[model samples]
Target: MSGDGEEDASLEFTPTWIIAIVCTVIIFMSFFFERFLHYIGKVLKRKKNFALFEALLKVQEELMLLGFISLMLSVSQVSLQKTCIKESLMLRGLPCKRESPNSVSHVTFVRHYQTNFPLDFTGMRMLLASESGGSGHCKSMRDWKSWEAKIQQEDDTAEKMVKHVHELQFIKKRFKENKIFSWLHSFGKQFYGTITIDDYRAMRLGFIMMHYKDNPKFNFYKYMIRALETDFKKVVGISWYFWALVIVFLLLNINGWHAYFWISIVPFILLFIVGSKLEHIISNLATKVVDQNAIAIGNCVVIPSDDLFWFKSPKLVLFFIHYILFQNAFDIAYFFWILTTYSFGSCIMGKKAYIIPRLVFSGIIQVVCGYSTLPLYAIVSHMGSRYKKAILPHHMHETFDQWLANAKTNKLKREETSNEGTVDKFWGAWNRKKASNKTEVVAKLEEEMQEVQHEPVPEIEIGIHN
Candidate 1:
């Protein structure tokens, strides 16, 4: 009996080790393939955006994207590898050859899953569950009670994967059924979802795909044209903020800033012209194409009048925000680049240039710009513009119009009565929309609250395991 037991253990151990080694190699190859795909994506995006010259600012952006994608792939690869290792160990230790990878190896569906490498099984399950449900009475069940601390200790991989699958499915199913539920859940999940290395990887491809799907006529040249337009504005914006620092460097120049004055002026003037032209093009394109989508989608509720100048669509507002933010961020980067280049120039010229002053000035400017931008973001967000519009009954519009009039009248009274009171303009719009879809929002809100109640208590806490 003792000899037989030893032989059984030996038989189990050898095959499991072989399988694990093979799987491990496959995982490594998958990671390598992902990296290759990422580089291809980057080259394509850069070409499309026409960030020619592969200039300092554009190069930095490319590097950041690569770093983020690599980090995400690393995290996911680690998680999947760890799970495989754990299963391998279990198979090796146990006397059960039946549980080896070979057991599921023959199953066509399982083989397909292994081949495709889908990141969001939870999403698939949720979509399936929603399709299974009828008349918007969607429901999901999860056995949270079995999720005890001891169970995790005994089966960490199984527990974690199961929990992740359950939570994601729940969110996805709820998203399809309720609008308010979709907004809150989607927004809330973004924090945990995109905040991680793996989450970044998962979303990066989706982002690329989404943009591509939106613009199918997207040739390399068109992409390059758009990219060049975007980048020109960015470079020009940076130049504006760096003008003061440039003057200071000119004063400190031993050969005299005058010697290279024309050279400097040419670049600055060219940047300004390019920036202005790009900004104009982008704005016009947005108003024409982007606003049209907003109108079609019903996202133009707040600004229903033909008063495009006075009341901007949410989509246009967002585009302008991106325009400003991108420009400012580039500007901040340019200041730092100047600081670097000038410091180098000073070193080569044997001038005693203390970079400390430049660093201090740069820090102050960045802080001021960052703080000033917050209000702009808030106003843009509150405008309640979206690319896609919510579909509602015709009666809802009349109801919303009445609510808007009341809210507008109330806002006017407050503004007239007190100098401190300005229009709570965005909320006034929301109040009007709610008046129109009083039934829909209310029903959606109620459904979301119930979902909150039904959600399984989170099994893992960051600081403590529960």
Candidate 2:
């Protein structure tokens, strides 16, 4: 009886059979729990929690992968399951027209899309015919068309309806002509013509906005405040040091305080290099781009005042230099002050009101740099004014009229010169120069130049003609 019982137990539960049973139960439980959660409407709430749960979910994925690897290692047996999947996908191709019955066609023909509007007639007809059998609505539209013809014999309803259809067609034609598709293709090769310097300025601002818009870590205003605080601290500290050095020389009867003077050299050199670099970045990357846009739009030059620069210059060079360097130095000077105070601690190293020469120098640098920006602004304004004049409506009209006059004058001059055997041959030299070269080389050069100059025009046809 014991042997028989052991044999029956072996038959009921082999290792492979136990493993398969466990796998089936585990798979079924996973599917059941997933469906249960979805049925309880927890899936939508879980999806909405993605932003908060992103990090946790990623860690879970990694942990799950590790767990699976460990499980495979521990288990000698492996199993594979296969399933079939089907899905629908939408794809774009050339637009095609669907065929309609004679009655449907007549109703569609009378409802033109150009001028007068019909309320969802096409949409309704299409939906009804597609969903339900077209037997009913199709017959109704046909009967309406015949009835409309008979009504037209005694009333102006038919004529009015026909006019409405014609107007609808006109509207459709106009809309098709001005479609976004046409605009893109038509201006494909005209980038330079449409994009001006003002556009570039706007683009520069856009780039800045895109980079910093949603980033909480980078606050431009806070950075500026830090810069300003750094500058102020340096200014006050340098003032205190200068007076302290004077007092030391008097109290100790020291004839020459060479050590103090020498120590000052290190700070000056460091501040100069750092300040210059900071100034360059600000002026070139930030201020210059903005000013360039303003100049382009207004057509005037802007000049910076002497406040922005350390050196005073003549008007002409100052105009160009100020625009180039004013904002850069102001920005750099701020950063320099911060570095000196935090890194060197030279500004606040001495007694209060001691007048440190280094501090005074920093202040002088800031004042000079700040003042110089004024003149650069003026120069920018001037250039911007000139640009404005060039593109202004009335001014442009005058310029165009003048251009026409100049063209006429040139034509007259050319005609007069032609009679005197003077063709003003521009290509004569090039032709002579190329005459000795290989025909293929000359032809190739000509072909290349032509290709460079050629602008392709888009072909547009209205209605079904194209």
Measured by lDDT, the strongest candidate is 1
Per TM-score, the best of the predicted structures is 1
Per model, state how many residue pairs clash. 7, 67
- What is the overall TM-score of model 1 with all chains considered together? 0.19
For 34-112, candidate 1 gives per-residue lDDT tens digits of 6874675577556543232233244345445545655675577636444443444533321112424655643332333
lDDT by residue for model 2 (1-466), tens: 2356546555355567676898999899878954664543454345543222332333234334435644663352222112222211111110112244343543233222111111112222222112222132233234334433443344322332222211332122212233354334223312112222332223222322444335322322222223322222222121234335434422332223333333434434433433332232223232343334422321111223333333422233333322223222322333343344444343312322322564564454333333322212222222211111212233355688999999999999998988665444656656766775767798899999999789687799778765
Model 2's alpha-carbon lDDT is 0.34
Q: How many pairs of residues in model 2 come into backbone collision?
A: 67
Give the Å error, residue 244, model 1: 22
Angstrom error at residue 113, model 2? 99
Q: What value does the lDDT take at residue 252 in candidate 2?
A: 34
- For each candidate in turn, the TM-score is 0.19, 0.16
